[model samples]
Target: MRFKIIFPTGYQVADILNDNIDINVVLENGDVFFGTLFTISNLDYLLAISQEPFFYASDLLIVKDLSKKNIRAAIESLVSGSIELAFTKIRSTWSNESGSDSFDTIIDMC
Candidate 1:
């Protein structure tokens, strides 16, 4: 099943997903971070740990239609360590912006 993850006003694409929940983050700028969901909060917070660093409460996207399949896929990806591989394949396919790279970067990174 397909699920739509929505971001709050100030939330970034990288902020979503926890280290315990197997998930792949697909950024608008084509940057993918693979990890598991370590914590999920009702206040639109998700804490995840990846190979690089630990994600905090402020770094998460709110998923509107959280579905079982989506969650399952995320878990599977995390367990298999395929999140990075999947991201590499999808990142390049993401369209690039023409405007201010810094602004775009900031927006996407948020």
Candidate 2:
């Protein structure tokens, strides 16, 4: 599966994140992170640790299309100590599709 992330208004992902194309991946197990997509058939060989953000890809599943206000609210919610709740509020902003994960492409609007 493929996924797209619609970032919040006035929000900008840092330039450092731009070169990390290997990070935009979604696992079949429902883990989500930004970078470039990658599919792994084996989880046993996977080991990752980071102080950056992390969340379940499934949390990105939307209930409806999102608005800018929704995106802003979700961003604000991030500091409330519940990542799941923040993601839940912004779920509408994320979308997924069926596709192969063999390419590296990123669109940086900033």
Candidate 3:
């Protein structure tokens, strides 16, 4: 008997994310940062932690089929101390096809 091996779509998504991609982020100081998006898995976005104008880093989740406004709002919510709320909103629209983690590592720096 032969068995068919099937893989989750998240695996594909994660593989794609391994490449460098462009992304934008607005800082708490009303400044915007531009940089590449990369990840081994969809769980973390890996945003920047540098004060340099060109330095960009963030570990955002790769939400599927979301509007630009929604993405902005989600990240902005984080600046407002609403982590779980933002995750909830993003998670509601996610199909779980990507393997990105919802938690953040920013606190680890402190």
CA lDDT, every model vs. true structure: 0.36, 0.30, 0.32
Candidate 1 ranges beyond 4 A from true positions: 1-19, 40-110
Candidate 2 off by > 4 Å: 1-65, 84-110
RMSD of each: 14.2, 16.5, 16.9
| Candidate 2, pairs of clashing residues | 24-35, 24-36
Off by over 4 Å in 3: 1-21, 28-58, 82-110
> What TM-score does prediction 1 earn?
0.22
lDDT of 3 by residue, 1-110 (tens): 11111121211222443433334333322232333334434323322433454533453444432333433443454546644432222123111125532222111110
Candidates in order, TM-scores: namely 0.22, 0.23, 0.26
Higher-lDDT candidate of 1 and 2 = 1
Compose the digit string of candidate 1's lDDT tens values, residues 35-101: 3333344332322324435544322333322344455554344435644433223333333245432
Better of 1 and 3 by TM-score: 3
Compared with the true structure, the alpha-carbon lDDT of candidate 1 equals 0.36
Where is the poorest 10-residue window by lDDT in model 2?
A: 36-45
TM-score ranking, best first: 3, 2, 1
